[model samples]
Target: MADPFTSALVRHVLGRLASEAIEEYGLLRGLKNDLSALENTFKLIQGVLHDAEMKQTKDKRVEEWLKTLKSASLEVENVLDEAKTVAMIKSLAGEMGNKYKRRAFFSYHMNPLMVRFRIAHKVKNMRKKLEVIDANRSRFQLTSNTTSEDSAGIASEISNRETSSLMPKICGRDEEKEKIVDEICNQEIGIGHDGDDVRVYAKWGMGGTGKTTLAQYVYNHEKVKTHFELEFWVYVSAVFDIRRIIKSICGLVDKQLDKMSTDYLLKQLKNKLKGKKYFIVMDDVWIENEHMEKWGELCKALSCGENGSTVGAPLWL
Candidate 1:
């Protein structure tokens, strides 16, 4: 799959595509409504593209959907760029000769209508493609929109924390991440029974030993994600509720569990996770088998009892 065009670039260009220049241009009169519709549709897809692009590696349909969106957006960019260039020339038509006037007239009054019609047709087809992708989102197990920036500030905070807690790259840990990655990649990671989940793995040291950072390094490693399709990070802290842990996993995959019975929830969770590789990092697990009973049950459900197995990784406390 092609490396996804960064969301930042799309957001930046789309912002200009929906600019006031397009809205106010007198020559774009017949084109305004279609341009506006295209802009709205683009906006609608922007939030979901993240999710789609994330799954593109796993699903070809998502890959195609993103490609289509990118192609349409690029065409819009080109059209808008042309319109801006024409508008600039038209503004100076008085200084230029009749040749320039004719050019400006064609650009403003005639060319825009054709541009508008073409874009509208493309956008209408793109909308149909989007509808198909939307209808099949559940087939990919997308429980919620993973790519939406629900809170820009919070996202920045999390990004900063994950990258280095707002610090410079002075305390690099490439080797540490590699070590963890090697350990994880060396084994077969899958959902399975207790015997399969019995690997003794733990990161032990004194307080503030950078265990969390080291664990996160492994968790976010590209190889680690390749080994596991479903990834979850839950900060266990002092409160060790198994239900809470299970809920966090469900939230990652966007599974609804409200008012459901325990057996039902487990069954649904198992069905949702069946045949897929998943990763769960129980941060601050405060080592105790007392927490194991519910954890064991979760393990069983995730393993689906029959077709499951597990690969072990460092469990930080």
Candidate 2:
């Protein structure tokens, strides 16, 4: 008598095999139907060719009709070849289905004995990786949590932060300024709603539409400057350097040149933006959806005021 577990495994494998066979059979039938259709189309063409001679053709219509019939014949041959391929695939899938069933049955009976061996092997490798990761993480955390022992180092870092805000000078953005200002101030132009909704202004005309300049103008304007509690400007050009972006934002907000690791920068950004109303400027964005996601991550870090709610007001150029 078969063991109960083995019997149950066999039953499950047979059920799956049956299901796969039915699917393959359906596919085979569909392919066979397609082949029949191709055959019928070929027959129809032959009938048409037979009747074409009855019509007296004075011009080159006979030659054209012969050429069309030849083309049709070639098409029918191609259709038959495709149908044959489909049929072969269906047959192969059936054989594979049977093989899978047999393999499953064998594995079900044998796998119990091997499970312990596999687990031991896997656990050995996993433990090694975990140990390495934990060691690295411990070192990183220690470094990150270090106390500032030197006052001069802290002061120098602070001074460096103060001078890093060398914003690119605004140039040739008169038309863009008019458009963006109008969009922001004019309610009819649809910029602000209850001062909560982030009015996204996209300037997607072409390259050199003064997108960056217009963004800078908006960033520095007295109205925008005073309205928001915190402002963050990140240059996310075609090359997506996440570390650089976070560093730039940190420098803008805290005014420092402290070298922050990628992980720490992200954490610091999130902490800094926890409960502040901030406007983040992402300049020179690429024409790809992935760039959008990177921007979204930075936005996620910014504190949007209450309930971490911040509206996405985008001005794209």
Candidate 3:
């Protein structure tokens, strides 16, 4: 009953729906992997804390092990954030309804699906490693003391007290925070500087380098907050979804995502951002080349402010 154009549109929409389902599956798998990793890490930390000799190490091995656990936990949090980004992308892809060119849709959506799957696989392997560490720590705890109840009770009490204290205050990277904030303040400012080109500041570090925390601090600083008329924060993890990013920005500005074409949404973004100095932070950036290029397209959409207008783009990887 439909015309050729309408039938093609329906096929396109169905294809996009299939892609969204795939993305959701991948994201759910990634979340499972992350949750498993967190559980193993928690068990490992608990086992380590229960060891009597852990507190008596001369090489500070226990401290180093605790630090590794903290880093692993942060990585799990980052993985969860990535899963959320993938879900948002999937949702936007379904809503966009084949608006993007076929090539753009495939490039932006299908390619990142591979990245998410690969990362999920890696997280699963890491989870196995954490489980092994947990087992070893548990064995050490069991064999360390088997004959003395009084001594065991005292050791257990001491371990429990120490863990209670240390659990609340996980180790963090202070120097990294200082350096990142300095770079963002110095390189990501556009309005006050006498430069013609927009300032683009990028922080490309490893996964657990505290990029998100560093950016959060810089984004909330008094000086940084006062410099830009409008500020936008976007989480562009491995799954690079432009429509979702736009929708998120709209939500932040208290706008809805319905009843807008890609072009219309972009226009609204430009109008909202035109002639006003803006600070944009893209956090937890993808490390892959393809994902990075896809993110560039999102940036291009947001960088269309009027000529002579100032825009600060700070990307933290």
Candidate 4:
């Protein structure tokens, strides 16, 4: 079976280790040694994460080791999450009285002590697991990927299907980039318009035509950069959820609105973009609506950027 824990899973673990292991505060001093050791061990595996991913296609033992590493990383992340929760509670419980704040001691002090002690034990156990896996790396004969060009030439597209936040460096799209730049600079798009007059521009093409990559390129271009004050890049998969999309956009704008009704979210979004010129890219959107009404509403919500903001989203069918 294809590995359930993909690069995203490993990326999360590596990122957490990078943040937590180096952090010298909030974490109890007693736990620092184990955390440091844990962080170094994870760094060793991080170097091989991508190589292991590719080799597993031809090796069963490597795939099993990847699964084992996934479990170890998950346990480490869980331990850190518990530590963070306790730390947050302690911070929230800033000051406390003696008799009246009985539970406060547990919240601010004892709970954290227990949390650290428990994590120390878990980290030691996980260290043993990792050491065993690292040793087996040689036994399984797994090696690092040293070449960019594989025998198959290379897949036409390398972007992940689920999501891509930062714009990645693509191989060759200079011609397409220039064409898009000309299109945007020519004033052919609705640059300064209200919701009533907005129209969708479709980049028509065939499958595997590099449509998404082209859009990503344009979204980060300098001309596009100078044109809008605020920018948001959101990935919309097969299932369409307006509520989720609104939340995602709000998050990009550095605003977090949780458990909100669709109407409230729309109102908050309207306020958020009331007078700001913004750019938004809703990438890989596939909706299964019987009619155009749902999409029309979605478009309307996007157009709620009242200050002449431009929405450049490439639709893929």
Candidate 5:
């Protein structure tokens, strides 16, 4: 009897709390314990949401409990959103130090200490509300949903799955596929100059949402085939191994290129790509901030293509 919508919301909030972006931003430094407690309590509540949904009509108290849980979950989501915003501002302030001195001056509210102080207060208050919710769980005598398991497994499976240009026929995505295909073939949308960077268009969403499938359709479309001189597809798994990735791209061009050293492959890749329009699908890319340098390295190689070269990838965020 669990509401599918509610379950999805809870799952999204949990993903946010456990995201690497949160850790990278250093949000909730002193209140890590509080955040963990909140996570655990949410899981427990999620387990019994089905039972509560089943009994809410007959028991007013269970209905109230569900209301409280829903409200708290939304509040937590808002708080985390605010944290992400402040952290992004802080990061921008650091990077633009003297370049945008006037803009950076107004970012006092993004000061890490001040930001943490404000968020910590909200988190502590939220924790108290969750405690009350947890206490009410036992009174209802609800049991965990048997189908509820760790979402990590789902994330892992998604990360491990490789995609290709061969996608089975699907529905409800023809309009979307046409739009992206238009962008790829439209000369006005991307740079056609020799020195311009490769145009990258990303399709992002939750796992199994047909992002890859849509990309597959676009890649194989007749217009796409007619528009580019070279095409490649590389599956970038969770570990952003630049050498492995370069090797894959090289192998796609010529299998013997796969055995070369990283530097040699990159040099050859640049040579082979010179003066030719190209289209590449880098599927399942999970590039984090730490991989910026390596990403740049790959871009350098891909940038050697003729005008209108493009790369597409599926993004999670």
Candidate 6:
């Protein structure tokens, strides 16, 4: 039988491939054809995932096939993740090259040519494995009857989890929580050169860490509550839709901003945040290479806040 996490992993990989950053990566590295081939292969596999799950109980061959597909899909996910991380690191290093000469060695080690070649080779191999698995499905008479709505249902159920400002009962994290709270509460408000600048404090680590939990404790602390006039908790998830994020920020203050366009929303947000001390928690943010401009735009919109305004982003690194 297929592992329960297999379906979720497959969905995540598909989502990653569909992301703008990956599309840009493909274009830049001349891997557009390879990426497209992988995408098509995954879609074929996805259509039969449900059918295979149901048939595995009745047929041992189907069970083994699911296992093989699951293993190959996981390897693909790992390679994609590694390539993305390397690409992001290299981009950052390039941006800071003038100031950080020490990053030269890192850049040399992560040569774009080498990275592209490695990713291309792995993608070709993974595609071969996936094609073999997809070809076998025909022998088993697997039909592509799984509707998109079915997949949507599963994805929605998995993505429905959210973050909140309500304090949670916890243990062994008081020290960390106190430190973060102090950082937020003690920043001089309207008193220095960078006083009005929105300071960002991010808890960067792997997923499943206590980052969000700690942020919650700090967000709801008595000090935090009194320091800022408005506080918002936004669950950004994987996709960074600027309009949605602005709508969320405005929605928290009982103002319903229209979703017609991002420009209109940002204008309204600027007015709403003007001269107020606000704290926003952008929880579960997964930023890629393409999100920098969007992030900068959001920050510009938030710049209307008064001194001591801050953003806490607990990134799923």
Report the C-alpha lDDT of model 4 over 1-317, residue by residue, as the tens digit.
35435444544454455443335336545666666666566555555566687888898888888888887778877876766666656665665445434575566445556656676687778778877777777766555442333211111011234455467788876887888766654445663333353434446443356667777787878987887778777765434546667767777332344456667777777777766777777776542332145456666656655444666656644
Q: Report the lDDT of model 5 for residue 67.
A: 79
Score every model by TM-score.
Answer: 0.40, 0.36, 0.40, 0.47, 0.50, 0.63
- The count of backbone overlaps in candidate 3 is 0
Query: Which one is best on TM-score?
Result: 6
If the candidates were sorted by their lDDT against the true structure, best first, what order would they fall in?
A: 6, 5, 4, 1, 3, 2
Residue 100, model 5, lDDT: 64
How far off is residue 211 in model 5, in Å?
Answer: 0.8
Q: Which tens-of-lDDT digit does each residue in 196-285 have in candidate 5?
A: 477888887765677788888888889999999988887775556666677666664445655667777778779888889988888766
lDDT of each: 0.54, 0.43, 0.49, 0.60, 0.72, 0.73
Among residues 3 or more apart in sequence or in different chains, the pairs in candidate 6 whose N, CA or C atoms overlap within 3 Å are none
Off by over 4 Å in 6: 1-15, 26-74, 77-158, 189-196, 252-259
Better of 3 and 6 by TM-score: 6
Pairs clashing within candidate 5: none
TM-score of candidate 6 relative to the true fold: 0.63
Q: Per-residue CA lDDT of candidate 3, range 119-150, in tens?
A: 67756765775565555554333333222342
Clashes of 2: 4
